[model samples]
Target: MLISDGLGESVVERQHAVGNEVDASVQGIVVQTGSITGDVHFRGGTAGEAAPRQLPSATPHFVNRLVEQDALTTLLSGPRAEGAVLMSTIDGTAGVGKSTLAVNWAHRVRERFPDGELYVNLRGFDPVAEPMTPNEALGFFLAALGVAADRIPAGDDARAAMFRTLVHDKRMLVLLDNARDAAQIRPLLPAARDALVLVASRNRLDELVVREAANRMSLDVLDDAESRELLAHYLGEDALAGDPEAVGELIRHCAGLPLALGVVAVRAVEFDCPLSELVEELSGERERLDALDSAGETGVRAVFSWSYRSLSAEAARLFRLMGLPTGADIGADALAALADRTKRDLRRPLAELLRANLVEQHERGRYRFHDLLRAYAAECAATDERESDRQDTVRRLLDFYLRTSARADYARAGGDSRGFVVDLPDSSIEGLVFGTDAEALAWWDAERHNMRAATLQARSFGLNEYVWQLPRSLMFFFHLRGYADDWIEAYTCAIESARFLGNDYATAYLLFEMSVAHYDRGDVDSSESYAAQSLPYFEAAGDTHGKTEALIGVGVMRVERGDLEDAVKPLETAVSIGQERRDLYTQGASLNGLGLLKAKLGLFGAAHAHFEQALRAYREVGENVGEGFVLHHIADTHRTSGNLEASIEAYRRAAELRLEIDHRPGAAASLRNLGNARHESGDLTGAREALQAALGLYEEIDPDTAAAVLDEIEVLPTS
Candidate 1:
């Protein structure tokens, strides 16, 4: 029989015959159900007898940290009394000292709970073993409460019921470490209105508050100061004081995680070596996480093993697979895709790993492995994950990104009204959804760097198709980010791949992208040569769009070289062809190029008309970045013709757009243009201000445009 009372009380009494004999034991509130030979008795201990003495382990050090003043304030003041479930959760990557803080803070506040203290290691993410069952935990708690085996309930359900009943009305401090979930922990909760329960787990256990009304505490990694203090504890004050520079490097190598820093310090102490030597070993990122650990209990791998041993097979496998992704952080949806499973199917196992503390969710809906944990996961994947499987996973992920980027780029490039689509072998992952166009753009913003790395990786893997398409999809990001080096590097690889594949169209496209990179980087001669290289291939392949883009670039290059007459024919022809093909964006770009050349040729009125037309087309298409360039060209025309006020207004508008898009280099250029306009207008104060800002930008980094800005500043008549 199973019985549960609403007010934290439950009872179960049962009897059985073993080989025609009776088996029974009773020492508490005994009732005989069947064939019993004993009565049960339970003894409760005094509160003073329950508290254990502090062991002579390493001294618990307090490293000063910027308390997330908000979380600290909320925790310290929000719900002070007991029935208030103070569900404070500290979440971070492994080695971030989540457990240490919890333990330290619990000990600091233990005086509030007068009855006694109880602790349990739930082993939520042990790598090699299953989490402790509720029965196993309940047995320990029962034993702690002075309930003997002979008198204790035989079943977990019964034990939990009695455990809660026993703790009711007693103001005890319960610290549940590495709890797997609310369910594993719910049965272990004391029902006393005044009892305090502190449950620590890596997961964002929203289920806790929903079920138990527990208040939450989220912990983050330590800052530089705290990280330093942690290292000082093991390395001693003198070593750190002798070399603050080395100390900073040491803290940085530890990645501001207390556990990692402590382990590194412990290693330093064990080896009896100079701190600078250890710094050199940790400087290499590939071996840093591994090198940070030394022998024995204090080592990071040992600390990690404790949590790893508690995981079931499924969770352990998922943990290993997670390290294979190229991304630095992962969302739930992406993680689900990576594991080839539904989020629903994976949630329980993920939660179990979180409980065991092997995996930590960085934030709500996102997760990342600890540096050391990631290293271990990488090691596991290298051995456990088959080579073919690993290759397949990488290829699928690369394809997913390539196809999605192509879709976004095609949409932005004003393709047909139909949405972009890619077929996947698995029907479950057929479509990638974006909430809005802005959301799609944000995805590019987040993934631009990773995509650049992917392009290089794809080329290294000899994926020729991906090599060509990556540059195609990455045009907007390359242009917007001003990553000239990465743009050139990606295209250089694509060029080699295209030649290898003997594909004329791919060669033309790669050459075109390479030309853009050179043009942006002020290598006008190389830009023209690359552009000329694409012309013959485009002509051979009969690709008009490629031919038009290459022609426009060549015209722009000639205009930049001061050959305005030579620029006129190609610019006009490219504009006519692009307009005839109804490629409005391309036509606008061609007209903008022609306008700049006209302005240089002293045709102000014609330049003005062309700039206005280009501006309108850019604005109509919501191409803010392109519109900014057009507005700057218009300003340049006004400045050339001495229309100072109009030039100032146009320059300001261009600067606004450039700043909006985080185009720092472009903004600097616009500021220089504004200085030129101010000098022409005879506003010396404003001119000097603008010129000084431009000079400051130039001094910080030398770019091609900076020389022109310096000439303008130098030619300004000094007061």
Candidate 2:
């Protein structure tokens, strides 16, 4: 250990003005003043005449030939020269020499800090390895700082605090190289005012600016002169002088990008080609891009590829698997769903990707890939995909979403059952939420496209069950997004899938949806036909829910056709089944339909009560649109029974909530009802205005409703 002795005029100033002079020749770990110097030597049985394995030679003059980032260099070097705590950032794009600059700067300033300089390759961009954890890097740092393994703190934060405490009041240099982000670098920062931190990352360390002053340097491609000097220095002073124009072209083609320069230089050496010849070959864009990987490292792809090749089997598989997804980025929880694994199982692979620098962890548990890098991973997956493997992988991904989404839907629907008894991947669903209404809605919104693709793809694979279940799972999004075509297509596909799967019960269930689509399209006969087709299947399958849906569809069709008497039986049966099943969304739809039928049949009291129950149930199940629709129907019942004031209040409530939920058709209906109530209450002018507005929207999506509303408007008394 090293401690500094104060030497100043004032007592406090003198105590703080400390310095250390480490003795180079210490037998064991020794502390003198503020410096620790120790000799590290070991002898083993095989040490006799044996040599250490040689590392490949690093590029010569790699640091010097490059132009320095003055702002970053001055910030990092100046503060530490006089003993001050500083954090400096060197950030740049791929192949920008961020790491080289940081490392070279550390070495340059090492002599000033006699308390030992430490470096950790955080591996921010390694392709397959995970970023080194704080504890792992800190352990290595502590050992370098003469702390034994047993004495190291067990926890990461503890270790970081201890490391910082140990280095406090000492003039030391700390270099955290290739860090992913400030969050990853913050813990490792030394506590002492005398210490300096040089952090290199592709990401700008904006976090440093929040609490402490930080100097940031962003690097771009080297200038033309700098590029030429580096090339001449590497290849010989006269190597490119004869063909200055060609040399300049080569540098320009390399985009003055340092990584490209190194790659081209290495290739020039390997092939013994003159700079002109290399330039000629590189004039083709393809050859120039390939040359970037000349040394199996340093170039963007080569550096990335080297990291990728070093992954474990699981991590490698994951890296390739992410390529299969159509989306650019995936939340970690959704990724775990895609992998058919738990988040815990996913950690190693995610870490490996982070370490290798292939996958970028953008936020607190979120990850993404660079666009070009994603293209590369996609290429890898395409080449790697066997027919069977591709099918199985897709099936697994679809099944995971279907099952998880089903759990979320059930939770949102207020079903108190133990989250869909399915074979879930092992892990607590901590990050993957499902219990709350908001959580379910959020999940559905985020995964809507994936769900659609998966549903369509699953159908192609003969996954009939998935086709039906997937549509069912996505009901919330389909309804919310107002994706009418998708709703029709998904349900149509589900109907075919149900038939193919030999599940007559599911076929009947989907026929109910076909009827709803037909009704939406104003094809009353088609709606009736599909609804009638479900009855026999429901009887055979003994599915109460399917029976109720079919009955509601038939009742609605009859009501539309003015066969109110015929609609009564099916409407009552549907209401009974919905109540018995306790399926609130289905129950609400049934009750709303039955309530409208009763109001038409001159049973206003029954209709009003039914509509109230429907509204309650719809709200309970997080179906606000349905709740609003029922509120409009409740107003209709009130208006029919001559409770004009009650009808106006109910209509107003429906209109407000309907608009909030983006229920355009429902809002139009509610507005029309409000207009009718207003007319009955002698507000003829307001009635004409409301009815005209409702008719316009109804004409757009439902012309039949518009015509009927128009007839009602014609009969309204003049103001």
Candidate 3:
């Protein structure tokens, strides 16, 4: 019932000699089991024929869920469920064992469905990962159901329909675990009457119960007996036999929560300490609800406080400092910077917290607090730590995020010609190191929520410099990853920070970035507004690069909005300014904007000349991606001018250059254009090859683009 890490079934290996006779010169003679067989053939069915068995292993020492388990079984098997899909939602507060119960019930019911089970941690409340969207979850389901990757639809609606169709007659168990809301889980449900879906969440999915007729079960904390039983199960009856009174007190202090009891039990066993000592500590922590918790009598803060108080001084300090940042989790390196300790010195303290369950090592090396635990830790920080110390901790933490983000930005850009520099604090000088763009991106993806939270925290603390710089540092990553909401939010914060600090230079820079972000999100009006607003500040600050950037932004927006006449003057002015200052980055960007305008105006020769100039400037600064952009534009001009051969060559070169810098979306676009150009030239074979490659890349990053490309591919000639 439990899913193993490897493929569900083991593969058999057999060796057989097919040739007629073995030579005497060979080392050994072959033995025939029965008789020589005729030629053997291997037949292939659809790939991934077996449904995915992704259920996590059930928890060990699961205790006292008899009534809840029986309720679930009755819901699943009752006669009222004869012809309808059974949907059950288990909801509870943090540390209430919702996921544990879900997994346990799922494993028990594994045999009820002939088709295998599928599970995903939606990470709805995860501080690090954004909750898994319905579309992404459906894609995973479709793949697990053996749908060929290329056959999967590129939109959520189509994918959902396909998923419903695939599971229509099949009896399967679908588990949507840790869902944030009904919307995230709804599209992933199978429409079949025979299939059952189980959802688990921290909040009650009222909509699912009301709209979808889901059976809702609200799991409360364990009762005193159940809590005591759980601890006894983990620590053995003999361990509790000597001090029944202390065990009762421990159970009372744990507030009947499984997670809290488990933490206390782990410590009781690890240190071989008397439960009476832990009880005393819990009773000694001022006996009040933690600042973050509103629960009066059922406070888990007492348990958290007791465990926290038991940690070594070093571990306890690190735990309080971890509360300073608003990020959901903190990486070990960032933790070091926050504590002003080296990575080597952090291992033992981190390990200490991990052992006590004050912090969880979620991913391999990254750690986070449970939402409740994080609140408790923050409360400790506010009550026990000095205000100045808290501010210093926050500053160090923000410094780490900003400096690391800047380094990642530089790495991803492949070296910037803008020559912008971030002055990191001495403590942050040895922040996280990334060796490659891919590594940098991976770290960014993991830390994105933390970064956003840290930015907000900086602003809240009146750290204006960090407020502006943090968002600026993250701009490249956010833009490249297409996080429009986060990009806009961070930029808005940065703009306010700049204004508050009365720094026109920073204001101009952020406005320009915001314009670009808005443009990327297709908000042309806002993009133009921000772009126009940036010009005056740049002029007042006498920042030529800022001025040139604003001009180019305005020009690009005008061109995109089809105002060619208005676009030309600003672009030309930007180009002139770039030339005067010899700023190659700005010059290349402006020339590219002009080329786009000229191309749109049907001045192909003029467009080609501008693109050529842009390419030369980009290459002079070693900006391969910028050069690729210019090359693609040049190819567009060539195509418009009816020079098919030149267009094809230019597109191919552009695609290659983009790929060389790992600009996959850019490469995919160039390849798609190349395919269209080749098709126009009657090269069907070349067109199909290029489009197919482009489609693969598009599917990874932009499924809507992939869908359009698929339509184009379908219209191409096959012969």
lDDT of each: 0.67, 0.68, 0.79
Q: Tell me the alpha-carbon RMSD of every candidate.
A: 24.9, 21.2, 7.0
Pick out the ten consecutive residues of candidate 3 with the lowest summed lDDT. Answer: 1-10
* Model 1 lDDT per residue over 609-633, tens place: 9889888777776667778889888
lDDT agreement of model 1 with the native:
0.67
- Candidate 3 TM-score to native: 0.82
Stretches off by above 4 angstroms in model 2 are 1-315, 327-329, 340-379, 382-392, 416-431, 517-526, 565-569, 572-594, 601-627, 640-643, 655-719
Cα shift from native, residue 382, model 2 (Å): 5.3
Q: Per-prediction TM-score, please? A: 0.53, 0.49, 0.82
Better of 2 and 3 by lDDT: 3
Over 4 Å off, model 1: 1-309, 343-345, 360-366, 370-372, 403-442, 579-582, 616-624, 657-664, 682-719
Clashes in each model (backbone N, CA, C under 3 Å)?
32, 14, 0
Q: Arrange candidates by TM-score, highest first: which order?
A: 3, 1, 2
Q: Give model 1's clash tally.
A: 32
Clashing residue pairs, backbone N/CA/C < 3 A, model 3: none
What would the TM-score be for candidate 2 when compared with the true structure? Answer: 0.49
